[model samples]
Target: MSDALLSLENIRTDIAQYHILKGVSFSVPRGQVTMLLGRNGVGKTTSLRTIMGLWQAKEGTLTFDGADITGAPISARARAGIGFVPEDMGIFGDLSVEENMVLAATNGMPDPARLEWLFSAFPALRTFWKSQAGALSGGQKQMLSIARAMIEDRKLYLIDEPTKGLAPAIISTMVGALRTLKQQGATVLMVEQNFSVAKALGDQAVVMDDGVVVWTGAMAELAESSALQERLMGLSMEAH
Candidate 1:
């Protein structure tokens, strides 16, 4: 974690009586996109939730920007420049897209330049500015969720399965938006099952199984080795 912007060491978490994370450890490098890839129920989402303070770590430490944030509140972590996009795409369905964005702004006002850039990245957001978020399509809602998180500048983003169940066309849009995010030098920790999207955006990859890291390497390496992909994720990238 020498140059890491975020580091997690021996993190342990429990949901009810079930131990979800078993001493998970990883480092997210500054200005790079790190992919967390694994089969379902492997603690990938749990790790992100713990990092965002949604679930308290029963043991171990979480550090962000050289400060220990293991015990910090979710709001404090957000204030420290940590942004989260949950697997469910947490959004205010009843609110207008514009209103949702406004609410996500830290100071009650978004930077015009950033808003402009986001709109360009996901044009449907600007297209449905006054519409209710619930009325939008699946891909549009995903765009809104990610756009809302970008309403303010963030140092690190924890995004879970942004392209979970979308059409190929919409996935392409998501890939474009993520490319824009990478170009802006955003530090991202994303949980993705889509191998194509992970390959396109990931600088590094972490493969997990049964709540522990099984492999850590470059995304290119994972992309190139079908045997490794099958061993870790239980499916080859070609099937993805």
Candidate 2:
């Protein structure tokens, strides 16, 4: 994958005495969305943490934009244009929505135009701009989490399960915003359990099992094959 924006080859990560990612490998091509699909506890989140430099990879190489960043610190990786939206959302609960966005901006202030664009994409952010982040509903909090990450332009974004527990309406809103991001040529590697969402947004798909990559190819191929989905993901697209 010469055109990949991020590549993890034989990545192995351990949390304490537990070995998590065992030789996981995948490539996120530039200016496209790659869906990291798998069952729960299959090292999907662990892989994202390793790429973001939150977890140290005991072995393998992590390359971003042709540069080797296996040993780079988390801050260094961020500076190198890698943005992450962890499954936990990683927001400041005590702060106001506006304060949180300001903190995510590199210049200590949100650019007016970009802020307006974001507010347009996520009108709820504008509706609750001065409210405490912790007080927002679950869906609203998820919106704020994604908004913070998109506050700055980056080469690649690693997001985990953006629509895990949202209602249909909220999920639709998220899908719309992500579609706009894709149109803007942002490269994203995301872990999502919702097969519908994955099929809607993913250009490529990487399936993981037992801490290793089990399948990789076009999302359309996987979406069109129920047998493949059942074999790799343990459930057919119809079931999801």
Candidate 3:
């Protein structure tokens, strides 16, 4: 990779009494999908939060596109073109579908091109455009959340557990949308529990353990390394 869109070097973050990230470092190349993988309680989600500035790093540095942003505030970080979609989906049940999208954005107005592209890919969102978010299904809300992230053409995306509880068909839709993002020149760093999905979408994979990065390499390595699959991911590669 010539230039990393975003890089974390020796990043250590804490949440109250828990030291969540311990010197975890990795670089996300522009225009590639990087999946962060591990079993539950492995700090994958926490790492996403840290990148968003929801959790500050006590030690180490965060650099984006050659600038040092280790001390930037949450809003400042967002202004610098970092998009995040958390596991909860972060939809306002009481609001209309469009309103939920408008509310999730930290920037000014949501871009029309972004919204249009999103609706076109996830046509289900267009069907429920006038409906309230509370009435929409889980998969619809997830689509809305992702659309919210793309509103301003952010350079990087940090998505957490995107496939959790989604119907298999809907998961396929989500995967397609992510592929669209990649084609449009966005770097994606995703936290995923499902191996098949990650392997399908990710160009590179990083495995975390107890707040530290235990493995980092291409998805091909992830697919072939049985020892890593069993040890770090806690998965036996016998078969489905």
Q: Each model's C-alpha lDDT? A: 0.92, 0.94, 0.85
TM-score of each: 0.97, 0.98, 0.93
User: In candidate 2, what are the lDDT values of residues 142-213, reduced to their tens digit?
Assistant: 999999999989899999999999999999999999999999999999999999999999999999999999
Q: What is residue 117's positional error in candidate 1, in angstroms?
A: 1.1
Global CA lDDT of candidate 2, please?
0.94
Sort all candidates by TM-score, best to worst.
2, 1, 3
Deviating ranges (above 4 Å) for candidate 2: none
Per-residue lDDT over 138-199 for candidate 1, one digit per residue giving the tens place of the 0 to 100 score: 88999899988888879999999999999999899889988888898999999998888999
Total clashes, candidate 2? 0
Candidate 2 residue-wise lDDT at 64: 95
Clashing pairs in 3: none
Better of 1 and 3 by lDDT: 1
Name the top lDDT candidate: 2
- Provide the lowest-lDDT 10-residue window in model 1: 231-240
The lDDT of model 1 is 0.92
